[model samples]
Target: RLSNVLKRFARRHPDVALTLRTATSAEVSDLIRRGEATIGLRYDRDRSRDLDCEVLFAEPLGVVCAPDHPLAGRRVGKLADLRDERWIAFPEVPGRREITASHVFALFLTHGLGEVAWTPVDSLTAQKRLVEAGLGIALLSQSNAAEELGSSRIATIRVGDLAASHEVVAVTRHGGFLSAASRRLLDILRADFTKARGTNASRRNGVRRA
Candidate 1:
């Protein structure tokens, strides 16, 4: 998605040229801080003292289970209700997983749910597959759940009153100057997400209406 945004920017501003490099959120932040990459797209909490950040969107998180799981048809309820389910989660070493696990743990702590049994997986796709196999439940961004939900391969249960979310943001070095190309790329990304956010909001609202 970030690369696509950059490509759109290059197309719009033909005179500008940028070398885009992709990395994990932490790697991107490190590259920007070390003056390697001019700008980065990462989660808001990953922002460091050496970087300045502009939040693009706040993405709601959801709990997913196999279609026939007991939680599938339940009304949105407390986060505690999820404590007993087997959980497929990302390994702790990845930057994204660190952020996600922290939030999940916070929810457990906040609700006095204690520790939950979770199995570490390599990627979101793997986690999804595990959930689809009825091996465990998993937490996912709504975007990642779209295809499965549409196919009835998985079902999502909202965590009532536990509205966990993550912010997507654009980051640059705190005092660094942006080249014309970098600035143009940032503009394109901001516009792309703004349009996407609106479209997604509309689609979700439409589904609710149905």
Candidate 2:
């Protein structure tokens, strides 16, 4: 979504030359720290001290599985219930892996379920394919799971007691100054996401429908 906003901004301001790089939140932060990129859009939790960040929006993460999976019809499940299930998880490179690992570890320590086994996959598309094949279950952002969940290609299982959320953020070097074009591009991105978030909030609150 942030990428799309940037694309539109570049089109609207053709005089601005934009170079964009998309990667995991961690990688984006690294690039900013190394001065490879002037500005970035990344998850708030993944931001580094090397950059200044502004919160854009918060999004929830949900559990996803094949339509025929045993947990498909379940409205919610406890984290411990997934102990024996085959899990499809993000690779080591993904920032979410660290967050997921911490959650898993905490759950295990509290419930004594021991360590759960999982397959590390790098791409969301591949992970979704694996879930649809009934090979395993996964954790995914609601935005990413929207199409599949709506089409019934996959089922969403809520984690009742778990608070899983991610925030999208805009970041730039702490003391670095942005060029006029870059600043204008940033303004466009902020406005675009602000509008999108308002729409999503309204829909979620039942004030409007998608």
Candidate 3:
């Protein structure tokens, strides 16, 4: 979803240099606070007064798994049924911020399934790949793995207790200057998300492999 907005940004501002560094939401906020980056996009809101945060949109989260998995096209009646399944998620640890795996892992614990099996993977692409390889299932946004879902390379399972969503927020240093190029990119991002908010809903309303 963000790639399309960036493609447009690149075409319109060919002279602008775009460097992307991916990290957890807190790390992204820290990068901006220390001036390592001018603008950052991340999941969830940052409470720090040091940065200006704008929520771009909220994305629905769901389980992702291999296409041929037993739960691929089926509805999960109870969360306990997944206790024996290996999950590709983050292991709860200190200073762990919820954005990727932590949020997914918390879902299980919230339901009293604290001992659920999970594999820690930091990269989003790698999580999807591992799911495809049948290593484990993952909780992810539909748009995050749109291509795989569209191609039937992965599938989504309807877990009644796992209905959740996370916000995509844009952050920048609170009292810092934004270059013309940076402002332009922000404008494009906002406009792109506004236009896409509706269609993206329909496209991912009933999908996933987890």
lDDT of 2 at 85: 77
- Better by TM-score, candidate 3 or 1: 3
Kindly give the number of clashing pairs for every candidate.
Answer: 0, 0, 9
Candidate 3 has its poorest 10 consecutive residues by lDDT at 91-100
Show model 1 residue runs off by greater than 4 Å: 1-10, 14-22, 94-99, 150-152, 192-210
Candidates 1 and 2, the one with greater lDDT: 1
Per-residue lDDT of candidate 1, residues 40-95 (tens digit): 77766563577898988877788889999877956666887778887887667755
Q: Using Cα atoms with residue i matched to residue i, what is each candidate's TM-score against the true structure? A: 0.76, 0.75, 0.79
lDDT of each: 0.77, 0.75, 0.81
Cα deviation of 125 in candidate 1 (Å)? Answer: 2.8
Q: Model 2 over residues 15-121: C-alpha lDDT tens digits?
A: 76777777777777788888899888776655456689887777767778999987795865577778777777765544552324445445556766687778877
- Which digits, one per residue and each the tens of the lDDT, describe model 3 over residues 1-210? 778888999999999889889787778988999999998988778888888999888778778889989899688976777878988865555544544456755677888876677788867788889999988988887677789999988998888766687888899999999999999999998987776676667666764333
Which residue pairs in model 2 clash with each other?
A: none
Best first by lDDT, ranked: 3, 1, 2
Q: Is candidate 1 or candidate 3 better by lDDT?
A: 3
